[model samples]
Target chain A: MESDKKIVWLASYPKSGNTWFRAFITALLNNGEVDINNLATDGIFSSRRLFNEQTDLESNLLYDEEAKQMQGNVFNHICAKAKQRHLFVKIHDAYTYNSDNLPVIPTQNTLCAIYIIRNPLDIAGSLANHKDDTLDDSIDFMNNKQSVFGKQEDEVNTSLQFRQPLLDWSGHVNSWTAKLPFPVMVIRYEDMLADAFETFKQALLFMGIKTDKQQLETAIAASSFEQLKQKETDYGFKERIRNTSFFRSGKAGNWKNELTSQQVSAITSQHQNTMAKYGYI
Target chain B: MYYYRGFGLIIASQIMLPELLPYTLTSTPDVHISIGKTPEKLTAAGTVHKVGYAINPNEYLLQFLNVANYYAANGNNIIVEPLAGSDEKSVRLFLLTGVMAAILHQRNAVALNAAAIKHLDGVVLFCGYAGSGKSAMLTKFIQNGYKPFCDDVCLIQHNDVKAMAAYPTIKNWENTFTGMGLPIPSTDNKIRPNLPKYATYFHDEFDTDALPVKTIFIIHKDHIAKSVEIKKLAGIEAFAEVHNNVYHRLQIYPMKKEAIHFQAISKLVANINVYQVTRSSNTGFDELFQTIQKHL
Candidate 1:
């Protein structure tokens, strides 16, 4: 059935397979050639430029609640003005509401969301590298309820991304998977790695994106971790963390070698319920 | 009434704007501001443009929810209507920033959302979206003996190819102050109660005179860059970058003055060197500042 929803959120915690999924989708759109630097989609949901263009106000002048409210308004504005059959917007923010009881992502405009989840154990190392912090610190961040990204606390941040409330990893996952206002499809990062074709095909079918077996296989081949790594080595990835490669290994269960027993236990204990549900234990 | 000189215009306002550089000359103001009733919406007969704001020819209106009721800019006059719960300081903040920016657009000037510093040879502007570290970089240059010409709003004089001096204050977050190893100055004017940024005033170090535009650096902070690097932009890339950095660009588009704005920016870019500064988050303040200094 053709879905009426125009907006689909590629939602995930940082270091999850969100970007990889985006790359696959980009490859599918571009006939099996993916440009790591330039994707088919617009930037992330919290992009300050998008916020400014949609709201016509400088985001720095706004308080957090005002910015959140504007984010909802901008989403509706985008949805109303969109010419495309489907718009995929990557969002790192957890599903939450502002003080006014409005979803940070407007429910009316959001047709559905694809929430990509990754193992906390695997995410710790990748997130640590991306943030240039210790693995323990990354674990701590994953547990901290007040964890926020792109905050303008220090130095007026001029980054294109705005303040995103992650609210910890389990919180992030649960927030999106809970009684969402719209339909949600959860895809595990590990599953995507094991069976790329089936996993991605399911996601595409769910988003109502037309695809053939050849297109799906070609996209899978083009966006493979090795191919992405080669592209990163050839031309730098804009989203790569400082002093680190964006396609750093993409290996699952590296926490087996990297995480200390204490670190592993800490993460497991903190996210035990969610980890067990996702078969990460 | 208080008189301030900014954006090459003499502004007279009923409220005291301590952030602006006081206009020294005894001349009639070009723009006047007062507390008055403004319409909830613009009723003028013209193409209504809505971006982040709704505007019509000769009139612009914006509301900041519970903070303020409305800010209206018409011709050379501005009216600030405060919401019932809004205080004097919050009203003035919106009036000075959003209202002033709208008025500048109404005046058909090329304004940039940037911070600038006056060097020995000429002035250089740092352009980026808010929180892109323009103010932080300007503050860094100021602390290192360079003089600040403008804080956030930069108005370009296309004819003379100069950058106009804006207010004599810098709005910075408390973390910025602490990160730079400086104390947060006490001020009653917080940009917002929940926001950590405060409007810090500068005195003798703030340059009030317009200076020739020499260079423009569009800054982008990357979490993954190994070091702070500067790359020169050329051709359409330069134009596109500069165009995106225009202050209140959305407001200008609605005024049907985009051609004029483009012409001004094109001329400005043609004469001055434009570079993109990629700063890694882990780069030390001193190192980042030194990299910019070497380029300057």
Candidate 2:
């Protein structure tokens, strides 16, 4: 019945600029030194470890629907018991309600949300590499309205994460933007690439993080794509797919070279409304 | 009624627990379990704890959705109230694990979230976050001729730091059975309803005798590496590793059992060798077995 308004959500679809933003925040918080393996944020929103620790329940033992319904309780518990003044959580689940018609992520515990949007064409290529699937599979995954991760039953014994339902790319964006119970800030992947300094500064300011121009510039440089890729190469990123790189080419318009015309058409056709609304088209 | 041996205690239960080895000792039971009507909420008993459980110095109550509610008091009794139409396997699974764990905490014992295997002169522990290949490595060890000590949870007494097996069942995923080229036993029951995981009983091979705490291997995952690496942890890091691996550590503070938990961890850390085994994504269990074979 009590509220713990300390959660700042970092939400995005897969292969968007979520990790990059996390890296920036990590570096910003750590005097401009970020360990690719250890980010400064609280772990992912769907982390099974956090779920088990917070609720004293074994998520792997429960059915997907049973666990999904308990997420609001888990997050609220996390907020209530958190020692940190501001707990930043990276999330991939769309803004959806539970079976109880209450938000899966309790609005009472949320301080704010930073929703990162990316071009679907670019996402298809990156998602393919991340998921160990083909480009076609990735495209279908992006367009599928019932897209979800960590749903395999066999993985119940070995996975460190729980199920995350993403809906579709369009649905994912609309779920966060259409109705807002908390303050929400939308950042585009392309804009981050275009003006890293201003885009990141605005994000920090939006979170009420105070830093001078020098510290912000230094943190940005420390978390540059090259730096993150090099760190991954040197120390091996835990988030990377077993055989693939997580910090693959960070350019915004690489879709022009990577995705075929048909692939682009498929994405645009499925997510045209969202793409146009965000000026991606 | 059925008699069983778990958490270094004799258990006489009204419900069937097919996973635990049958009790053979003639001594009186340390714990008794029976069917009873439990309160919907435990506010009257004590302060409501986190995760909907309630606890005081000696009594603890926990509920599993659509399964059963379990109450433990003074480390000697457990009361189960099953939901209507609840399956026996589901009810017993919760009773044997979470309920038993709560009971252990009440007894001032430290329950670890790791599998225990008989190695050398004592038991060696394989612990990590879920999916860190602890069970796979334990399975590999079993295939290679080592004895199974305990699966899932390994209990340590707070007063003596002796390692104890609460139950002798390996609750493994269905694929673990097939992946090892073995068929799942026809009698194997699902650990929970609507889940592919099954509890494989080790009644004949389970070691019931208390053993001295020995070596512990903490498995880790390295995404990009091509081979496995093992490192020895000493001093504070080793202490923290063992302390953090306590089963349901989040429940300790709420139960006001931090003193017992801390004392048990400190005793275990002082007496054991803790090693961290980092397995690359491409590394197979055989290579991990080979890497660990030299240490033991």
Candidate 3:
């Protein structure tokens, strides 16, 4: 009965245009009341928390089979709670949910997916700014990549353990956008900026949510970059992201100025086909 | 330096370990036994030689040795569980080590030789022969929303606060999990593949930091239509059901550690409801699953 609720997941490798799109959608639904503060981001369109709170691993205890089994029913409860209210949830993972990794709600059933693409060069620049490192520093860290972070907002502890970051930009991107099980509508950050209204319509059609002239105008005005960022202060829910502003430098072509020629060539060469296919170049 | 003597037991110099641990550091003649908890775990707590075991390809042995040493060095306790063995001493040692670890891990729930999975309700045990439907039951239960606990081996820890189940991956069927098309049982392998690289059907969702146990089922493949009656078994009959229904026969070692083995099982079987289930070819596990649902 629950899978009947058409769950459309907003998925990306990490830090694509997911957060921006999330803010946009939230604005549209809440009558342009994009809460720059309330960072639970709602249960919608956010999959990373579901993942974190669910997965089980070995620490070598005698055996507690029961605890391991109920590890991920978070969404089940949420589904029950949201039956009357909303659809759409967030999943930060890039991997497709196969039967091998069955979610309580069956992630494969997620029919509509909004995958946001960003120039990796810019993602690297963004990473550098947040971690307070130079581009060379971040690239060196990326070179040792094995596991990638699930979200841009995810914390990397450079604290007691000095180590390299988990994944290179290209590998991270490929992981999020590969062999998806459902019908996906891919949009790029630059594309959204160049024609915000068009992309908005495309997303609206994808979600089956309709709007008139005033509703559309209100959603756009509320999500405008400067206006939303301004609400970051004095919003009670904004405290979670206070550590690293989720809205850091919300513009494009910044990758051109921020990345060195060598860095550009590296990411471009690494993501040659993806960039060409997505028309990012 | 001034030293105060109490009980004339060299109270002044030696660092006081908890009263539970026996530490003898003096090395002067017979006075210095220089005993250590050893570089290995004291499985039964009184054994003289704590055997170090590494079973694998000469390749795997080296890796295990490295792991053993790493764990031993950490000062956290280490025990070498019997790896499905023939050695009488080995089986007893495995049970001893498992029970001791369970006891040390907490105060209440005793570790026993069974498998379990947690439901939204409470803790449940799946008991059966190696091929009997235990893992299959877990597979079904997990698909129907049961959280997999331990597959073949279980370690239960309990106390006044709560009874927690361990999250251990158990092998069920051989095909890839994707071949099954279930929720989470499939989506969860991203971080840890519950299955060994060469094997399949590993990993499960974990719930609760822990939960309490409430029921046990002794599964058999015999179909219910085959005239096998499903009934509640109790007392020594229940004990026999759990022991004989084990995934494997007692490794000779643990069987020889009869006291610990008996005591651990007694502690476990005494608490929960146990049933001897004969599979009806017609019923599949529907009857058993319904039975569990009815109670919990």
Candidate 4:
């Protein structure tokens, strides 16, 4: 890999601050002046449209042979454009997928990998609130390997209780942290919020991106929960954004008020170690 | 409504997904199938199993794409694509394996327009838009120690695990293969010529499992610059760039499922990273490949 090009594998199952963190990092790295009220979220690494082809941008649709091949070609273009300053992404599929197989770009230029883990209990509450499924439903889907939006017969019987959320939480974290083919720097959303500046500093260092005290304070203040929410109202509703408010609540421990006792125990029992690591229990 | 089989999936349209392609069921897996066409006799092939409701033709075509034109328009994700049959030749039972992949990506787990094949190094999409360099790349990749997932066209089926592409043919274009600076399309079973009777270009001897869509590199030659350039795109921008440059970007005919299809591609684009490849990158083809190797 080229010494400068970065391959930041921002792994997290779903709603584990993957997007939230991605949004914040987007704000910070751009001009190093964080905009707490309104953050920008458009990049080759996200789901937004760079080309005017006007194709659907849903996250679960299937691609035909031509479309798939085209994606590879365009991705090569994007990687070259971003060079070392770009954010190459992976949705955390567990398998260490290397891009070199296709020979689309300078494979050796890969430089960095980053992973983010959040409390599953909190994530479950958020997903259930936003999406139609529940934590229990998500769990079964996770273990079983299917989705409510999908057909039934081919579905597996993992028997997850609110499995979607749990799986999102577990899959996102475990896939990257447990056993990785490459080195990755893991960050917890809770820990990020618990001590914003410290976490921010660590993240920068991991990327070899050094920042002074001023930049540190600026990134922190810009990424603050309150600042992000206000930005969501303005930029969140913007049509260009996939979602107007990319930032939801950044507080930790909200699981206590949001989840039912059963949900709590289910998450604790299911993801006990991970939850405990972040002191979510 | 009827059931169709190919690869390992029992494509049952009409009953389960309300949003499948509109097409009648044909028992046999025929790439020459059309949205309005159905086999005279429904031949029961267990290759495809239908468990849900009776599959309909319209929904099936809408879902798994039965026509060649429709595939040519929007099925850009496919690697081993079926040739759209010009005066020169036609591609049948085409399969596509996405090269430049994501870790454990299943971007095309369902859909009839594609197929896959796994090899030692990973997956290499056998792709091109007639002039986009599909066979040329295939021959070169093979000569460079790569394997085949499909030739010009690939076969695909949906399954419980994911959408899969089928191994078909190399159909090494004699002159074209040599043009790519590789051996003449060898007699290897993996390689074959387009057979006129079977409605396919060639019977490729090899193929692999479902690989995720990794990157998209456009092939355009700049006589002046004579180099290839690579760049990365982030978020919606990357998705848009990829979805449009796709040869079949406008295949919806009525464009009814444009939004739905875009969302589907977006999900795929979101999960994996995307990039652009300059035609031959300012460096010659080999240097371009080396450049991609070093950075990606």
* Most DockQ-accurate candidate: 2
User: Global lDDT of each model?
Assistant: 0.81, 0.82, 0.48, 0.42
RMSD of each candidate? 2.9, 2.8, 22.8, 22.4
- For residues A111-152, could you state the per-residue lDDT of candidate 4 as single tens digits? 556777777777675665444466666555433332322121
CAPRI quality of model 2: medium
B272, model 2: CA deviation in Å? 4.2
In order of TM-score, best first, we have: 2, 1, 3, 4
lDDT agreement of model 2 with the native: 0.82
Query: Stretches of candidate 2 above 4 Å error?
Result: A1-4, A83-85, A153-155, A204-215, B40-48, B157-162, B255-272
Can you write out model 3's per-residue Cα lDDT over B134-236, one digit (the tens) per residue? 6657766776876666555554442321234333445543332333453333423322122211112332344434456677788665421344467788889
Model 1 docking grade: acceptable
lDDT of 1: 0.81
Which candidate should be chosen as best, given lDDT against the real structure? 2
Interface RMSD of each: 3.1, 2.1, 21.5, 21.0
lDDT of 1 by residue, A130-153 (tens): 877899899999999889977644
Q: List where candidate 4 sits over 4 angstroms from the true fold.
A: A32-77, A88-109, A134-168, A235-246, A277-279, B1-296
TM, every model: 0.91, 0.91, 0.43, 0.43
* lDDT of residue A9 for candidate 2: 94
DockQ of each: 0.44, 0.56, 0.01, 0.01
Worst 10 residues of 3 chain B by lDDT: B56-65
